[model samples]
Target: NLCSKNKINPLIGSAGVSAVPMAARVSNKVGLESDAQNFLLMHAMGPNVAGVIGSAIAAGVMLKYVLAM
Candidate 1:
Protein backbone atom coordinates (compact mmCIF):
# COMPACT_ATOMS: atom_id res chain seq x y z
CA ASN A 1 0.00 0.00 0.00
CA LEU A 2 2.79 2.36 0.88
CA CYS A 3 4.59 1.76 -2.38
CA SER A 4 1.38 2.15 -4.32
CA LYS A 5 0.60 5.38 -2.55
CA ASN A 6 4.13 6.69 -3.03
CA LYS A 7 3.96 5.79 -6.70
CA ILE A 8 0.69 7.60 -7.30
CA ASN A 9 1.60 10.69 -5.31
CA PRO A 10 4.85 11.44 -7.11
CA LEU A 11 3.39 10.67 -10.51
CA ILE A 12 0.53 13.08 -9.87
CA GLY A 13 2.86 15.75 -8.60
CA SER A 14 5.18 15.40 -11.57
CA ALA A 15 2.32 15.47 -14.02
CA GLY A 16 0.73 18.45 -12.38
CA VAL A 17 3.94 20.45 -12.33
CA SER A 18 4.88 19.62 -15.88
CA ALA A 19 1.39 19.88 -17.32
CA VAL A 20 0.37 23.22 -15.87
CA PRO A 21 3.18 25.15 -17.51
CA MET A 22 2.99 23.04 -20.62
CA ALA A 23 -0.74 23.66 -20.96
CA ALA A 24 -0.34 27.38 -20.51
CA ARG A 25 2.46 27.66 -23.06
CA VAL A 26 0.84 25.29 -25.49
CA SER A 27 -2.53 26.93 -25.22
CA ASN A 28 -0.98 30.30 -25.84
CA LYS A 29 1.27 29.29 -28.73
CA VAL A 30 -0.64 26.57 -30.61
CA GLY A 31 -4.12 26.56 -29.08
CA LEU A 32 -3.95 22.86 -28.38
CA GLU A 33 -7.13 20.95 -27.55
CA SER A 34 -7.88 19.29 -24.20
CA ASP A 35 -6.96 15.74 -25.22
CA ALA A 36 -3.80 16.94 -26.89
CA GLN A 37 -2.83 18.87 -23.81
CA ASN A 38 -3.41 15.77 -21.69
CA PHE A 39 -1.23 13.74 -23.98
CA LEU A 40 1.54 16.28 -23.82
CA LEU A 41 1.30 16.36 -20.06
CA MET A 42 1.53 12.58 -19.77
CA HIS A 43 4.55 12.39 -22.04
CA ALA A 44 6.25 15.28 -20.28
CA MET A 45 6.01 13.48 -16.97
CA GLY A 46 8.20 10.64 -18.31
CA PRO A 47 5.75 7.85 -17.45
CA ASN A 48 4.85 5.97 -14.28
CA VAL A 49 8.07 3.99 -14.61
CA ALA A 50 10.04 7.13 -13.93
CA GLY A 51 8.49 7.44 -10.50
CA VAL A 52 10.17 4.22 -9.35
CA ILE A 53 13.40 5.35 -10.91
CA GLY A 54 13.16 8.66 -9.10
CA SER A 55 12.45 6.95 -5.82
CA ALA A 56 15.49 4.75 -6.24
CA ILE A 57 17.66 7.72 -7.06
CA ALA A 58 16.35 9.61 -4.04
CA ALA A 59 16.98 6.64 -1.75
CA GLY A 60 20.50 6.31 -3.06
CA VAL A 61 21.19 9.94 -2.37
CA MET A 62 19.84 9.68 1.12
CA LEU A 63 21.88 6.58 1.81
CA LYS A 64 25.02 8.29 0.64
CA TYR A 65 24.29 11.29 2.81
CA VAL A 66 23.70 9.08 5.85
CA LEU A 67 26.91 7.18 5.28
CA ALA A 68 28.85 10.40 4.85
CA MET A 69 27.59 11.62 8.18
Candidate 2:
Protein backbone atom coordinates (compact mmCIF):
# COMPACT_ATOMS: atom_id res chain seq x y z
CA ASN A 1 0.00 0.00 0.00
CA LEU A 2 2.69 2.45 0.97
CA CYS A 3 4.79 1.50 -2.06
CA SER A 4 1.84 1.92 -4.40
CA LYS A 5 0.95 5.25 -2.84
CA ASN A 6 4.51 6.49 -3.14
CA LYS A 7 4.88 5.32 -6.72
CA ILE A 8 1.48 6.51 -7.97
CA ASN A 9 1.39 9.78 -6.08
CA PRO A 10 4.65 10.93 -7.62
CA LEU A 11 3.48 10.05 -11.14
CA ILE A 12 0.21 11.84 -10.53
CA GLY A 13 2.11 14.88 -9.36
CA SER A 14 4.61 14.81 -12.25
CA ALA A 15 2.48 13.62 -15.11
CA GLY A 16 4.03 13.23 -18.58
CA VAL A 17 7.57 14.15 -17.55
CA SER A 18 9.36 11.21 -16.08
CA ALA A 19 13.05 10.40 -16.07
CA VAL A 20 12.56 6.81 -17.14
CA PRO A 21 11.94 7.45 -20.82
CA MET A 22 14.64 10.07 -21.00
CA ALA A 23 17.09 7.69 -19.48
CA ALA A 24 16.11 5.01 -21.93
CA ARG A 25 16.54 7.40 -24.82
CA VAL A 26 19.99 8.37 -23.65
CA SER A 27 20.85 4.69 -23.22
CA ASN A 28 19.67 3.97 -26.71
CA LYS A 29 21.76 6.82 -28.06
CA VAL A 30 24.78 5.19 -26.51
CA GLY A 31 24.57 2.47 -29.20
CA LEU A 32 23.21 -0.28 -27.01
CA GLU A 33 20.97 -2.74 -28.78
CA SER A 34 17.36 -2.70 -27.63
CA ASP A 35 17.59 -6.10 -26.02
CA ALA A 36 20.87 -5.26 -24.28
CA GLN A 37 19.48 -1.96 -23.04
CA ASN A 38 16.42 -3.70 -21.68
CA PHE A 39 18.56 -6.35 -20.01
CA LEU A 40 20.66 -3.64 -18.37
CA LEU A 41 17.55 -1.85 -17.17
CA MET A 42 16.26 -5.11 -15.73
CA HIS A 43 19.53 -5.65 -13.92
CA ALA A 44 19.25 -2.18 -12.46
CA MET A 45 15.51 -1.95 -11.82
CA GLY A 46 13.86 -5.34 -11.98
CA PRO A 47 12.24 -6.95 -8.95
CA ASN A 48 14.55 -9.93 -8.90
CA VAL A 49 17.87 -11.09 -7.43
CA ALA A 50 19.83 -8.15 -8.83
CA GLY A 51 17.39 -5.67 -7.36
CA VAL A 52 17.81 -7.42 -4.02
CA ILE A 53 21.54 -6.97 -4.34
CA GLY A 54 21.06 -3.29 -5.07
CA SER A 55 18.88 -2.97 -1.97
CA ALA A 56 21.50 -4.67 0.09
CA ILE A 57 24.16 -2.28 -1.20
CA ALA A 58 21.92 0.70 -0.42
CA ALA A 59 21.27 -0.60 3.07
CA GLY A 60 24.97 -1.04 3.63
CA VAL A 61 25.61 2.54 2.56
CA MET A 62 22.92 3.80 4.93
CA LEU A 63 24.31 1.72 7.74
CA LYS A 64 27.77 3.09 7.17
CA TYR A 65 26.45 6.63 7.13
CA VAL A 66 24.60 6.09 10.40
CA LEU A 67 27.60 4.48 12.02
CA ALA A 68 29.79 7.37 10.91
CA MET A 69 27.35 9.83 12.40
Best by TM-score: 1
Q: Which ten residues in a row have the lowest lDDT in candidate 1?
A: 9-18
What candidate 2 gets wrong by more than 4 Å, as runs, is 1-47
What is the overall TM-score of model 2 with all chains considered together? 0.33
Count of clashing residue pairs in every prediction = 0, 0
Question: Candidates' TM-scores?
Answer: 0.35, 0.33
lDDT of the candidates, in the order given = 0.47, 0.43
- Report the backbone clash tally of model 2: 0
Give lDDT tens digits, candidate 2, residues 13-58: 2222235444434434343453443333332222334435666788
lDDT for 69 in candidate 1 is 94
